[model samples]
Structures are given as structure tokens and as C-alpha cells.
Target: MRKNLRVAAYAICVRDGHILLARSPADDGTPEWVLPGGGMEHGEHPHDTVVREVEEETGYRIEVTALLGVDSSRRTFPGRLLRRPADHHGVRLLYEGRIIGGDLRNEVNGSTDMAAWQDLDALAGLRRIRLVDAGLRLWRERPAEGRVQR
Candidate 1:
């Protein structure tokens, strides 16, 4: 199997019983909601990456308040003919954030199509990315190690 690794940062911004979310563009023809974040750029700090990614995906300037936790996940993907399957590992940093400024707007032609504040109580009915649940768990549980076990 081919191996791949990725490091990303995400934010949990909840206010007024709503959670901030970005609607991911349908890669498999099924749109899913996710936290406002993405993979880090080369030479960038994870903190800076979260700020940049949140702004890009949600059109909101955020102040990172606390380190929620880190989450690690692995998956296998089918490869093309004559190639081995790909094994991917993702390490994600989840942070608590407060919206400080900027207006809400959809990211144009980005990984996510739209951003919105969703009712927390209604989340169970929504189609969402796994990261959403992971981030929320970190926010709620706040384990001492600051890492969620897969």
C-alpha cells in the first residue's frame, strides 16, 4: 500500500445554541458539513493555519481561544490499475474559536461550497463529515491528553 500523511487544523465555534459549519463540496456527490478548517501549508504554524482556513471557508475572522484536542484517523483508498491501494493518515488539531469579525459568505470554488451556523440540537439530522463529530466530542469531553483516540 502507498502511504500518505496530512496535518490539519479545525475550529469549534458555537454561539447562541448554534454551531458554525462549512458545507463541503460533494466529492462523492453527497455534500457534507464540516468544521471551518483545512490542511496546513508548508512552514505555517497550526494556529496560523486554523485562522487562515476558517477565514477562507467561513468568511469569518476568528480568535482561537483554546486548544480543544487532536484527532488522528486512517483510511484506505482504492488506487488506479497497476497501483497499490493508498493508506492515508490524517492528524487534525481542534481548537475553540470565537468569531471576532467579517461577514458570512460562501467560499468560491473551494473545497466547501457554503458556510452557515447550524442548530446544535438539529445536527443529528444533518449529513456531516466525521470531523464534525470528532471536534464536538473534543469540545465536550476535553480529555486531559488533548488527543482523541481513534
Candidate 2:
């Protein structure tokens, strides 16, 4: 099996009972909502990655305040070789962020199509990526180790 590893950062920004979210543009034509974040550039600090990614995806300048936690997950998917599978692992750092400035706008020709603040209570009914739930859990529980086991 082939192996792939991804290290990323994400932010949880909530205000007035609403949570900030970005709509990931899926090639499969399925709508997927996710927190504003993505893979970190090489040699970039996780804190810096969260701030940069949030701005790129949501068009909001964010100030990362707290390290919420890290979440890790692994999955297997079809590989390049016929009938073979690839192992994919993702390590995501979740952080508490506050919008410091910048007007709201959608990312242009990027991974996400739109950005909006959604009602937190209504999130359960929306089609979202797992990172949303993971980020929220870290925000809510705030484990001492700053890591969520999967």
C-alpha cells in the first residue's frame, strides 16, 4: 500500500451563536462544508498556517488565540495500482481564532467556493467535513494534552 501524510491547521470561530464555515468545492459535485483551513506550507509554523489559510479560504484576517487541540485520522482509498489501496493519514491542528479585520468574501478559484457564518444549532443538518466536528470538539472539551485520539 502507498502512504500519504498531511499536516494541516484549522480554526473555530464562533460569534453570536453562529460559526464561520467555508464551502469546499468538490469535484464529485457534492457540497461539503468545512472549517477555514488547509495543509501547512513547508517550514511554516502551525499558528501562521491557521492565520494564512483562514484568510485565503474565508477572506477574514484571523488572530489565533488558543491552541484548541490536534486531531488525527487515517483512511484507506484506491491506489494508483489496480486493486491496491493507499493509506492516508491527516494530522490537523485546531485553534481558536478571532476575526481581527478584513471584509467577508469568497475565495476565488480556490479550494472553497463560498464562506459564511452558519447557525451552530443547524450544523447537524448540513453536509460537512469531519474537520468541523473535530474542531468543535476540541473547542468544547479542551483536552489537557491538546490532542484528540482517533
- Candidate 1: worst-modelled 10 consecutive residues by lDDT: 23-32
Name the 10 consecutive residues with the lowest summed lDDT in model 2: 77-86
Candidate 2 segments exceeding 4 Å error: 80-84
lDDT of 2 by residue, 1-150 (tens): 878899999999999989999998564789889999999999999999999999998889998889998888999987654756879899999999999999899999998999999999999999998789878888888999987654
Residue 4 lDDT, candidate 1, scale 0-100: 91
Candidate 1: stretches off by over 4 Å: 81-83
lDDT of each: 0.93, 0.90
The TM-score values for the models, in the order shown, are 0.94, 0.92
- The local distance difference test score of model 1 is 0.93
What would the per-residue lDDT of candidate 1 be over residues 33-149, giving only the tens digit for each residue?
A: 999999999999999999999999989999999999998999998987898899999999999999999999999988989999999999999999888988998998999999776
